[model samples]
Target: MTAPRASIGALSSAEFLPQRVSLLYRLSGNDVPAILLTSAIAAFALWGYISDKLLAAWLIWLVLASLVRFVLKRAYRLRQPGPEAAARWEGFFCLASAFVGTAWGVTVMLLYPEHGQFHEILLPFLIGSVAMGLPPALAPSPKSFACLIVPIFTPLIGLLFTQGGAFNTSAGILILVFSAVLLALYLSSNRALIETLRFGRENERLLEQVKEAKDRLDLALQAANILIWDWDARRTNVFLGGNWAIILRVGKETSALNLDELAQMVHPDDLPKVKQALDNCLNGGESEYVAEHRVKTLAGGWVWSLSRGRVVERDAGGRALRVTGVNVDIDDRKRAEVELLAAVQREKELSEMKSKFVSTASHEFRTPLATMLSSAELLEHYSESLSPAEKANLLQTIQGGAKRMSEMIDDVLTLGRAESGVLKLNLGPANLRELCSTVVSEFRIAQGKQHVITLDDRFDRPDVIMDERLLRHILNNLLSNAVKYSPPGSEVTFSVSRRNEQAAIEIQDRGIGIPLEDQPRMFESFHRASNVENRPGTGLGLAIVKKAVELHGGEISLTSAVGSGTRFTVMIPLRPVKQPAGVS
Candidate 1:
């Protein structure tokens, strides 16, 4: 995870020698000559007493060298040492050093003509060696050797042709032979050194490749979260690593792996599919065998794994001899898939239920609503001729039908609010005992002798906070359903109580109760049980009650069994209905 550090020693692998050496490395061409002049001055300071004329001659060469080197340094615009750009600058340094040594050799040959032949040749040899030892891209191998050879051989040619001092025929032959021998030695040594450098560079390159490959493999194994496996189908041997045991929940016993052991982990339902995939791989009928299946864990849980692989080698019969692959944990992905499918199925069911509700509501509400409207029109026309009793009964018939129609319309609106998630609440202070008594009184008048109703006001009436309209709708639905389903003269009780910060109301009915199977879906929109078919009801009544109670921050629950009485309880937060002092 840490970043690789740049090599500081790459630029200065050789120890610091002197400013002259550093300058010689940084500059190129004639700039190198200036460093040589500085170096010559330093050398002469140590050996100046040897001869005055020799020192003066050296000084003259130094002045010429310094002037040439200054111009070349300016033209090259050389860089200094740093990590960001060490290689490029250091390479230039090597080139400059090569040129410096060459220039110095040239200066020595030109000035000291009387020096022995061996000495004259020594200068050129050192120049050539410096060039060959550095990076070869700068001052090429053949060129540096050729240049040095020219200077060394020039003296030999002079000794052979000139009729002056130290130039007899025999001496000329010896000089020529010496030059040839030195050239031969330089060539052989140059070849040998180049071979050694080539071998070293090849080994370093191979080592780097191997290191990089190992790093990649290690990272892949660690980060992939997959169990890598290899199977030799012909040999009946398999290899697996990368935490297969942990994925299978084998309690840290991942090391012992065989065909039978692997089979034991597979789920009974998925074993056939896994066996088929393996059979195909072994028979040479398939190059790839991949499957997603469940495998039972040691703790009785199950894991979903995606196994994928391809034939790594084939035998003479074309059957797979080896296959390499991986098994990836896919339990989370499988669970998400199942959840998505269930959600889609539920959505389909809900859509169908909504359609059925619309159909039933249109048919059932139209008839009663039409009858109420017609009765109202007829009653207005016959008002003058009708007896007092006749008038009252007709008026009551119209009112009752109209009220029922209104309740059905309210149920539809409440369902819409529940679905849209925009049901509004208007919270205010209201008395719990007064609220229950009022609901019971209305239901008693509505039901007449068909149901006997009682109100139980047991809770503290210090007031509770609730949305008045929504709470009324909730109580109305429960009381109406009780009245509709009860036998003639059955008792329906309304009770109110307070607990902690909330108030609860219960509407209990002695009626044919809900079956156990239907209880779970009683509050779903448009859901009605089969036994309640002839009850003259829209199933939206209880659903609307649930939504209305929830809108006022309440919960509604039903407890019932077939043939027993049913109880519907509504609980709302008291904070919404708490009455102020001096208020009813």
Candidate 2:
């Protein structure tokens, strides 16, 4: 064959052939029709010069060759699907086309037409018309199309030029132009067909890759037991992945679910909060929604789930149209986080209490130690020179300073026991009336006999089970504060009563009252009222009292106003449950 036209805008044969192979075999059906039609039309015209037997023989050969090409195409489709085998079939198809076209062209001279007009004009026009239509069947392989074209026209056009006349020469040149136009069209169509097939093949490869990736994603999700979900907000419908069945406590088969049905799986107590968070994200112009909530599991129990999502599609009015998110099983992580946070908070509290203890202890200890040092020095240096009463007064001052230091140490030890949760109690029968009386007497001495410390006990059998040492610490700190914080001559009343099998102790002081804001945290360790800075305190008294009461299995509540005196009521069960069950 003459050199095939340069393939413009076409894939390399290696890439194109594999995709174009089956299509080339399919073209065999179209080629047979065109060959038979052309042979039949040419036979009628050729009868003018050729004998009927010869003409019929040529037509029969074309028909049989066309039939054989069909059989080869079928076998190629079945056994020769690979590109190398398909390449051989393409060569055979092109050769068959060229052989038939050459046979038809040579007959113009071999038969030597006697009807001159039929040979010159009608015959050439018929051949050119049939050649132009060959591209549809053979265009994918441009070489095969060109093989059919040149064989039909080259000899006929050459014959026209050989005839010595202007009509003959011009007709020959016109035929050449027609052939050029036909070749250009064949090249264009061939280029388009190859490019189209390549594009389709590439598209199929991409689709397969996407399918494989989707399968991998599903496998990963299933392995992790993660549920992937998409919520169409406008439709209120949810599309869940296959793994959703693992978490959904339902039958084997499930139907479509709406947003409300999904929300129903959330714990009832947490559902309102979950809905609020979702509403805030969807309606409050926030694109993201995240929450850790308990979702009912397949066992009808709750598991903590962390759901995270964002509005991926929205309407122009800023409404959520679609939400995409994942529900990751976060039960273990959530429990761990809660425990860690509690531990961290406890550590923080201990740090603050220790810091306040260091600062307050240093200040409180320094004052009493300094006072005792001064009193001891005065007695040692001036005892002989001073009057008997002067020596006696200094001795009392030393005793008082030492007593205050002892009380501060006791409070500190009590606090340490409470913090370490190893507080030991000695339970016994104790008289509430005598307990109040004794605590008041200590208060009377500490306030220099000026403040009126009175006891009002309204109990018949005032005996109760309690640890007397903790009870004493509780009473001592309250009475000391009552005397220390109040002005001289203010009455501090201690009241004890029994009712409903619970003993209640009330300490009423006319001291500078606690502020409302400070009341909440007043019992917290290292917490002293903003108004109590002028007083000498370790900031541990109230904290120790609350711990002591809690150990006694009771609760404490306080009511106070700034500048008005504070009243503290402590209640204890008549029968305290020491080492209560589930306490640890």
Candidate 3:
């Protein structure tokens, strides 16, 4: 019977009591380590109630609760878990609360039946109910009211049984009124708690959503390669995202900058100009700000950025407090512009070269053609008086010169057709064997008895779809090259075969082959191999060959080496075209 130390707060007796209530609540539904405390409370309440020292029983229960709380605080530190794990623990907390609630109700009924302070039970029951109801408030689970409602109803039933006709009618009426008041308080308290928790939970959810949306927006800006910046028009304070620092290769340390520090970072040549532009934007003259400047980088290099901004918000005084914008690295675009300008200039020069080429070619062609025509006309008039040898020489000279002029005209025409994309191919079936034979025959007549031109025994295709005129040109070019480049006694041979539904024609010659270094550009317009300096060509032959082959959906390849022979293989599809209606 030592008086308890002064209670901690307004309800000192109750103050000590709440801890025991809380412990019993915590241990009831949970796997709390073997708590002998709740069991002790039950035994002591029952013993003290029978002994009739109501104060002693309540005090004993309170002391045990306080001791258990102290130990729980010491043993289980209330450190926050990682986000996901904490959510699971919240549910456990609720379930544990429900079990603790039922146990506390049972213990209160068994212990201290004479205290009749039904209100004393409200603390543990409310806590357990709330625990069961409001778990994972910030987490993703449903709140359940069953724990609160069940514990609430259980206490009422216990109250009814406790006051069951044991007292006089007046005393009984007083007990019933007290119980009703406790029930009302409990209901009101729970409603208040639930409303507060709901508001807090909704606020947290909104904050989380806002944070996620901001994160997604930041990611999108980075993906678009944009840099963000903000400025206070009145104070002229600048805020820039980390990407802005990255673009300039600058370390983004925080600094209290006035105007001078900012101006120092800009290139000396651009500083004044940029300041003026910023001033103009701040004056509300324009909603947007655009400027180009160079900034010194931490890496000791200068980078160019195209900065664009706009006034985001302004004070009532019309002073802009916030401006937001982006800065873009435009160095590549600037360099490309310079290169494009240079390319345009080069094109102008190439156009001049074309003019010269046309003028010179026309003059050269007119001289030979005019001589051939004059010679022919004079011969027609004076042929009877002329000696046979003189007439024959004149006729031969006229023919040779006319052929040269014709070849030059054809070259000019070919170049024009190729450049303008006007080259046409009339595709039809041609006999591969016959085409090869015809090419070899022409070469033989052109070469006379100097060199041998032969078709290999391998020539075998029955027919192939191709433009007959283009194929004739391809064959003529290959054979003529072989005849012109081969040594006096060297043999030029043509071969044909089929593989995988396509036809291939090969021309092999014992001629000076192309050099390795010049092969890449060999099919480029106006390009000629170094080894072919002694040959006469317009440098359009192989380029035309490549273009024509591609147009036919086929390809050509050349295998050659210096001082060795060359092999030109032209592979064409079996069907180069499909005829439209009425075509035969």
Name the lDDT value of residue 582 in candidate 3.
Answer: 100
TM-score of each: 0.58, 0.51, 0.47
Model 2 alpha-carbon miss at residue 314, Å: 14
Tens-digit lDDT track for model 3 on 412-471?
Answer: 687678678899877777777787777788778878998887787464556667888778
Candidate 3: lDDT over CA atoms? 0.64
TM-score of 2: 0.51
lDDT per residue for candidate 1 within 1-584, as digits (tens), equals: 23322232221233222322334334335334444655465445535333444445545544553454455455445544444443454454445434544564555445544534444343333333333322222222333345444554454456445645543455556556655766566556644544555576688899999989867874676466577888776545478767666665656745436788778878888999998997887676776788888877778888898999988887678766788888888888899999999999999988988788778787677777787777777787877888889878777878888787887787787788877986777777776677778888887886778888988888976666677777777888888877777778999898888777678788898888888899999988888876786677778888877877877767989998766678998887766444459989
Candidate 1 ranges with C-alpha deviation above 4 Å: 1-272, 284-287, 294-307, 316-319, 325-347, 366-392, 576-584
Displacement of residue 343 (Cα, Å) in model 2 is 3.3
All models, RMSD in angstroms: 11.9, 13.9, 14.6
Candidate 2 lDDT over 1-584, as tens digits, reads 23343333334454576556567678766667776787678777667665564466567756765776687678776785566676776787778778866876676546544335544545454544456356666776755676667777788778877765776787778778877877777777777887787788889999999989988987887677577778886565788765566654444535357877777888989888788888888885566798878877666888887788888887999888888888777777878999999999989987987888888888888898898899898888888898989888888888998898998887778788898997877788786678778777766776676799878878666466888888998898788878788888888888888878888888898889998889999888778889876777777889999998998887777788877798999988888545558876
Better of 2 and 3 by TM-score: 2
lDDT per model, in order? 0.66, 0.76, 0.64
Query: Rank by TM-score, descending?
Result: 1, 2, 3
